[model samples]
Target chain A: MELFESGACDLAIKIKTGTISSEEVTKAVLQKIEQREYDINAYITTTPELALKRAKSIDIQRIQGKDIGLLGGIPMAIKDSIITAGIRTTAGSHILENFIPPYNAHVIDKLLDAGAVIVGKTNTDEFTMGSTCETSYFKPARNPHNTGRVTGGSSGGSAAALAAHECIAALGSDTGGSIRQPASFCGITGIKPTYGRVSRYGLIAYASSLDQIGPMTKSVKDSALVLSVIAGYDNRDSTCLNEPVPDYLTEIDSGISGIKIGLPKEYFEEGLDSEVCDITMKAVEIMKSEGAEFIDISLPHTEYAIPTYYLLATAEASANLERYDGVRYGYRAENPENLYDMYCKSRSEGFGIEVKRRIMLGTYCLSAGYYDAYYRKAQKVRRLIKEDFDKAFKTVDAILTPVSPTPAFPLGSKINDPLQMYLADIYTISLNLAGLPGISVPAGKTSDNLPVGVQFMGRVLDENLLFRLAYALERNVGTSLTYEGAVV
Target chain B: MSVTRKDVDNVAALARLSFTDKEKEELIGTLNNILGYFDKLSELNTENVEPLTHILPVQNVMRDDEIKPSLDQETALKNAPKHARGHFVIPKVIE
Candidate 1:
């Protein structure tokens, strides 16, 4: 009867066999949401009526001997940034508080086609900018593991929903560690596929070059199952690759034999927490024992990632968000004296402090006097960062490092200091800069009981290699801490 | 390395967000501290390095010149704050 704890594939089989009716499963998950929704603050909008309607349709199909889809009767959640037709899609900002999208994102369309029931829209940071979900107009999502700590942002709500058993799996966008970090914080698995691997037509853009839509689930196989359905080229997004999508679930149990993982010295440097470092090294040793070779690698530009990412992301954000002026759609001032007043009042009132800060920094970097000095120079550094990853990949199949320097901090810990919050994304940002694929798996737990995640970064379109290594580590780790009463 | 109030005002204007004088003063301090950390990048000699815009090797991905159906006017204008005659309406600019 507890459908939230089962894997998506298993749930589909149960539905097919009539072991559990789709209506019963939906009610169980809705009951779980009713119990824990306030504690985690995961869902911004819950759609029980729509979910029941969809479940009844699936039951009808089964009774008539029609073919049901792979994800038939499975309940799922989507990050608020992804548009859902006829649903209120607020990107955790006041700007579009009342805005209801008229169309679904490309991935949403795919999930519906697969017969997956979308239960709700999860919370996120405003425009997917902050590292902590605290920036949302809604209440900050709490870490289901530790109530006082944070669920990582801007996909924190999606991750928290999975961790708390509110949903089996969810969709999240990783612009710069949005999906991976939150998954790490909430003790779950998440993947950011290679750039152009998935369609981004319906995803709200934060940084066009860096944003990717991927899966956040309770296990590696579940993440891959969702990826198999969503990863493909679409004509709607010109940047989407026209290559063949891999059968990720087919290789979930593939052993990691003769696999080589790179351990970059730069990632284990001074700033990383001792507890995080110890757990990561243990994870590396576990992989080594599983017939995986360890090689010492150098990515000298690792330290430069923080600055390069902030500069480039903000610059793009300034340009992309320009479409939200008062004239067209989105929020507007109640009363405006003039044209300029309307523009200023609307933007100033709608955007949060962090969003405004990034926009200003972006505008400055792209200005007439500073463009060549700041923006252009940062772009050059971004090239060297990519080269570092390219050069390292030649010696190793994938690179392993801590997803974050530390476990999830307290809710309001880094909200005041923007730079400190940005620093939390140090390890995950460079992968975005290089457009590589990265996956985060449960590495180990800190001494104080917080979950630590180890990230595997792979070469372009080499997501299979990363998944193989992650599955090996997850099996070898040998400890599955239950969410109930695990927090100290 | 210290940012000035003038710098904050200029950046705000470029970003098209109006800030009160107190907010401007606060931002000046914050921006200066943040920009000060970026000085580390100047130490590295990146003269010959080319600026990398995208990670994947592919470039210039273009769609075919085929016309497609667009969103209807009603659906497009549904979220607009003010609209008239299938177009977004704004305050009059010219006298």
Candidate 2:
């Protein structure tokens, strides 16, 4: 395979062993980005000069007998939401279009410390409010498989970048299936670690409780390798778990023999496309052949997840986004009649339609008369959803479901209907609400040749199990995409 | 339970956001559509269920009182739209 076509794990080995120079790999990826990025629209920014400079330095360090960190010299794309010191982190919003973060997010520090070279920031839905990249203030990232379709968002750009071989691996933050859904669409492996598994210090907060940063990669093993580097506690984010970080690679190759997996009946009942259901069941058959048993389970409250998520997530978002007034950083209105006018005008003009709608919805939910009726009630139901997982995990090691109800729809299909778009997350949002870990591994493709990924959700902090199962599926099913170095 | 235009205006104001009349009218429909879906939550009995704000078990994540270096005035104010004398200049609050 070409340098840019290899997984991060393979690239890391080649760079470490001097079999291939980091400079060569970096050049190949930069060239790939130059060639295909226009078609995919995966990145909001591309830092070719900085990436090459970092790659050269890492090459020098390796020559000088210096330790090149875990991902040393590998080119990676970061979700624009994560703050990068001195880099324009727009979070795919007009409000922060020209904003440059003065400090690195916690994960950026870890990646830099590990010697990973950052290529650029990937596009996302404005403040990650929408599932499709169409909601982004920038051009939507079209699926690498089919340019006419979306690369399922709000981490759509990251997924597209990886799938298109524009970058070896990428960082994606998931709040209500941003990472996993795009990975499913782009035919890549994406993991949304348990809520507190990764630090949230630099991630532009959407819903503080639901937001998490994880890895999207070419293979399940690459996800494990990247997750190992990024998954650890930092004092900057209080919600980050102070638990011990496991070397996921150690237990990754462990076979999933006698592992009990659950199939939640609610996920299959309605709204699930027949092809997606068949693909999911086919993935189950492969796992079953590999000695993993499947059990019928009921997450009775699954139907309520969407409503619960919209209420709670939007409520938190309304409050978290309140900091973006014209005062500190980000866009400010050109001229204003008064302070209130400036605040109102800057925000209304800065934000897009979906973001404004969410803000409005959130404000209404948290308004004085509706607090108990909406936000509080959703919180209670959120507990019930988590309880469903907790109860099921007692009987099964993990649960299996389709990552998205259907594969990537056409770009403008559901953008006009907000409620219709919300239902797309019906299957994935429950895990986010429950603070559980979930991974999307490419299963197969639809008749239209679009990719489909099956989701494997595990108990909190049990990412190793998810990786093991994911690896088995990838190994046996052989659904790995052929990177022919061509952009459709 | 329907979100009227007046409610959208109130919420938009509460959010420190202003919408054009057309945007407000659009929001009235979108907000009501979303809020109407939220009515599904009321069907369940959450009478005594404890609300889960954060899923993590850790709370009151305290740190020591020791001082640590923070962003200098220049770096902190670097991105501010209006800054003077190392302070963010904003329209006068009490005028």
Candidate 3:
């Protein structure tokens, strides 16, 4: 098998058994990235030298008969928003185009300790703000399945890399379907662990309460492996939970005989594509045949989720992004005549159109005259939205829904309409709002052959249940990989 | 309440963004549309609903007040567009 096509666990075993050297595997992946990166736009930076050196060091440790950590020498790409010491981490924005971190994020530290080889950073929507990767200051990532379509954002590049076999597995951040939607679009598996299940210590902040770092991979088991290495408490992030990390890999393939899945009625309402709805329902039927029971669930505040998310996210973003003024850090205008001009010119040039739009909306909601009407009211509505999920989880092990209203839209299709763009996150945003764990597993393809993802949301820290269900669904869904210009 | 073009302009300025006249006109329409949709919230009886800051029941995860070393000023300023003597440089505020 091609090095990039090798699963994370398979690669680790091969390297340890002397069937393939770590250096050889790294070289193959680097070569594949060099050949295909331009078409997919998967990577923002390629660290071939560092990757090869790291691979060699791992090989040396293996020769010394030392037990390397889980995922030793596996090539992994990270979302650019993640901080990697000495590596340029842009978050797909011009504002921090040259920014290099002096410290690693907790995930990065864990991945390195596990002996995972870091290939490069992948692209994202600038500051992880868009559903489609189109808003990136860097080029929008193309869906490896079809070049005409987008790989979903803000972790579009990470998913795209995984789909195109540019990397074995990649890291992605999901604020509102950033990871899952893109994973769905790219026909890969992605997981968004419950908020605080994974530490956010070195992730560049978007909306602090909603942003979560998660895993994107070619298979469900690979995601479980990656999550095991990264999910843990950290002293740096106060929000990170202090609970013991569960043995996720061991829990896979646990029988789904008694698992009860809930399908929310509102998720299949009118705006859902007929094809996506059909595929999702068929997935439910398959689960039922596999001895899973289904129940109809209602999350009545679904209508308010998009609005509530926007208000709260933007309100928080307005405060979180306040540090980016020309005074503190990031890009500043050249030769400004005054401080006000410096701030205006620098931000105007630094942020892309989408980032600017969110910042404006955020500032407006939090502005003095509008705080009560917008920000405060939205917080109250946010409670109702969370209550909707809390009420649903009482009766079900997990709630199932479509990842996006439709499969990946064509690039530039909804870019001009901000509201239309925001609505794309409808099914996924409420999970973030409720701070629950969710995963997007490829259910099947539409009749037209575009991949559709079925999302399973679990209660807080119930990622183990989510993964077991995803693994079962993944086995039933079978492989649906599609490449542009290739026969499905 | 109806949002006006002046509201858009003021918010844009406060956010430190510059927009073209055409972009401004377009955004005025979009923002108004979004705000119109949000008007639905006013009809709901949320008088007794408590505001939700976080969904998880986590709170007050405070850390000790002990001083820990911070990133060096040079490293912090490394990404600044302009810097001088380990500090980010900006244009003069008042002259």
The candidates' DockQ values read: 0.76, 0.84, 0.68
Residue-level lDDT of model 3, residues A413-459, one tens digit each, is 98888888888889999999889999999898876677888999998
Report per-prediction Cα RMSD to one decimal.
Answer: 1.7, 1.3, 1.9
TM-score of each: 0.97, 0.98, 0.96
Model 2 CA deviation exceeding 4 Å by range? A479-488
lDDT of 2 by residue, A1-488 (tens): 57888889988988998998999999999999999988899999999999999999999999998999999999999999999998899999999999999999999999999999999999999999889888889899999889999999999999999888899999999999999999999999999999988999989989998999999999999999999999988998899999898999998888999999999999998789999999999999999999999999999999999999999999999999999998899999987888999899999899999988888888898999999999999999999999999999999999999999899999899999999999999888999999999999989888888889999999999999999999999997553445232332
lDDT of 2: 0.91
Local accuracy of candidate 1 as per-residue lDDT tens digits, B1-95: 45688888877877779999888988887787788887778888999998877666667877779988888889999999999998888877888
Residue A357 accuracy (lDDT) in model 2: 84
Q: What DockQ does predicted model 3 obtain? A: 0.68
Positional deviation of residue A362's Cα in model 3 after best superposition, in angstroms: 0.9
Best candidate (score: TM-score): 2
Give per-residue CA lDDT, model 3, range B1-95, as digits (tens): 77788988898888877788997887778778877887777877788988888767778888889998988877777776677887666677666
Give lDDT tens digits, candidate 1, residues A1-488.
Answer: 24667767778889988888777777777888899988899988899999989988987888788766777788899999999999889899888788798888999999988878888999899999998899998789999888799999899999898888888779999998999999888888899999999999999999999999999988887788888889998988878888898888678678887888899999998889999999899998898888889999999998888888888899999999898787767899988887877888899999988889889989888888888778888999999999898899889999999999899999898999988888889899999999999999888787667888899999999888777888788787632234323321
TM-score of 1: 0.97
- Candidate 3: regions farther than 4 A off: A479-488
Chain A of candidate 2 scores what in TM-score? Answer: 0.98
**Model 2: which residue pairs collide?**
none
Q: Report how far residue A386 has shifted in candidate 1, in Å.
A: 0.7
Q: Would you give me the overall lDDT of model 1?
A: 0.86
lDDT of 3: 0.86
How are the candidates ranked when ordered by DockQ, highest leading? 2, 1, 3
